[model samples]
Target: MTERQILLVKNSWSYVIVKSEEAGQLFYHRLFEIAPELKSLFKSEPKGQSRKLINMVTLMVSKLQKLDEIQGEIKSLATRHHKYGVDPAYYRIVGAAFLWTLQQGLKDKWNEELEEAWVDMYAVISNAMIKNQQAVAA
Candidate 1:
């Protein structure tokens, strides 16, 4: 998938539209199911963490259409995540959970096109975050 196709998915309401109180809980549940050990890192109430996740993701997606404008914000987020000890593998976990949520959220509408769009989009965003993290390390 091209970057444009990826952006089409990112700018969609797929993330924010389906974003609900229950969605967060479901995300955590699915996340733990895939990566049980990561559960220990979230030392807060599930609801609180889920809210944070929802808000953070919403903000990120909202800014995706203007990535150049949000470069600093993205860098800051990546830096903070680094301090939190979030590595590439952890990103994979979150991405997987996110995709699962969309799949469940969109149901029949969730086609291979959407899946590829999300995968490509994740690669773009994750690489940007990694680059930002590396820049900070340098």
Candidate 2:
């Protein structure tokens, strides 16, 4: 991603981060709406799960420019995700829900540039997480 794109995501994220709780709630609500079958994969309470989601996203967004630095962590997260029932195909749906949630939160601040920037960032992160996984260990 270009430095301009990275700045766009970070700058827009700053506006919405203040209401992260609501953002997390919206994300899960929208996610379940789109992929109800995936809801069963979650083992924690909704509130706690939301906190975990937001916290991880916050960490990732902060490190967007140096995603390689967090590659190990991202891959480990992928392993946990596999154990939690996330399939390789599900990243697309997750990205959709994530982008939609960001739009809902950012409102007027949401634009094509920010959306594209986020798409780029998510692609990089998801690729890192998925590149090493062939199958979930039994």
Candidate 3:
């Protein structure tokens, strides 16, 4: 991603962190609404799960420019997710939910440029996770 794209994601995320709890609730609500089956994959209480979601997102957004530095961590996350029965196809479902949540959270701030940057970032992250999943399956 370009420096501008990275900045856009980081700046937008700053607002998201202000209402982190609500954002996490919105994300899970959207995710379950779109893919109810995914709810089964999460075993923790909603409150704890929400915190985990926010923390994970925080890490990703903060490391946007230095994703390579977290490649091993991302891979480890993917491996754990695979054990939780997370299918590769679920990445798209999660991405859609995430984008929707961001749009709702950002309201008027959501725009084509921001959306494009987020979509690209999601793809990059998902690709890394999927690669790790595939390696584990092999």
Candidate 4:
């Protein structure tokens, strides 16, 4: 990612993280709305799962610049997710729901640049996850 995009992601995330719990709940709600079938994949209670989601994504975003350090973690997450029965195609739906949740949280601050930066980041993360899933399958 470009420095500008990295900056955009960091800056925009600050706004959302302030209400991390709410944002996390919103994301799950949106995710379920988009793909109701996915609801069964989650084993944790809603609030707990919401907190976990925020925590994991927070760790992932915080280490974005040093992704080399987290590649193993990310791939392992993918492998665990694969075992949980997450379809690879569901990543795109998750991305959409995530962006929508961001838009809802960021409100006036959300824009093309921010959206693009997130799309770029999500693409990288999800592609890695999907690739790792494939590797694990093989």
Candidate 5:
């Protein structure tokens, strides 16, 4: 991510942190709505799962500039997700749910530039996860 993109993401995420719980609920609600079958992949209770989701997003956004530093951790996450039978295709669905949740959460602050930055960030993260998953399978 470019410095400007990182700034946009970080600034927007601050708003999200204020209402993290609702944002997480909205994310999962949208995710299940988009792909109900994915519900089976999650074993945790709703509240716990929501917390995990928000925590993961927070961690990723916080480390956006130093993503390389966390590649190992990201790969481990992908490996665990692969064990859960998470398909690479599901990443797009999750991205859509995430963007929608952010838009809903950010309200007036949502814009093309911010959307693009988030999309780019998601692409980077998802590609890393998918690549790691494929490597593990290989």
Candidate 6:
């Protein structure tokens, strides 16, 4: 993607940054709706897990444009996620929930380009996460 496209994606995500709480809520709600089984990974209560879920997303969104700068942190996060039983497939589910939440939350503001941006961002983030897990396993 061109720098303009990158900027577009970053700008679109900027809107999400302002509404981080709502965005995280939407993401976790959609995630649990799709994968109720994963709920067992969280504690008996959902509040703490929910906070963690949202906080992670919020951090990811805040750093989306600076992937290289935060690679180490992302790797650490991926490792922690693994300890919680998160696998690559769980990344897919999280991505789906993330995109769905953005689309539903943003409504008309979302378009093909924005969708592509989000997809690309998720790919980069998830790949780094998976790679980190693989490295640890190796």
Runs in model 4 lying further than 4 Å from the true structure: none
Instruction: Show model 5 residue runs off by greater than 4 Å.
Output: none
Q: Tens-digit lDDT track for model 2 on 18-90? A: 9988998999999999999989999899889989988888888899889878877787888898777678788
The candidate with the higher TM-score, 3 or 6, is: 3
Instruction: Point out where model 2 deviates above 4 Å.
Output: 135-138
Cα lDDT, model 4, residue 22 = 96
Across 17-133, the per-residue lDDT of candidate 1 in tens digits comes to 665677888888999999998887778899899888777767766666666877787798889877777776688878899889778876777788878877777777788898888
Number of backbone collisions per candidate: 0, 0, 0, 0, 0, 0
lDDT of each: 0.77, 0.86, 0.93, 0.92, 0.93, 0.76
- Write model 4 residue lDDT over 36-117, tens digit each, in one string: 9999999999999988888878877888898888998988898999899888999999999999999999999999989999
Better model by TM-score: candidate 2 vs candidate 5: 5
lDDT of 1: 0.77
**Cα RMSDs, all models:** 2.5, 1.6, 0.8, 0.8, 0.7, 2.3
Name the runs in model 3 displaced over 4 angstroms: none
Where does candidate 4 have its weakest 10-residue lDDT segment? 52-61
The candidate with the higher TM-score, 2 or 3, is 3
* Candidate 2 least-lDDT 10 residues: 129-138
The TM-score values for the models, in the order shown, are: 0.82, 0.94, 0.97, 0.97, 0.97, 0.84
Q: List the residue pairs that clash in candidate 3.
A: none
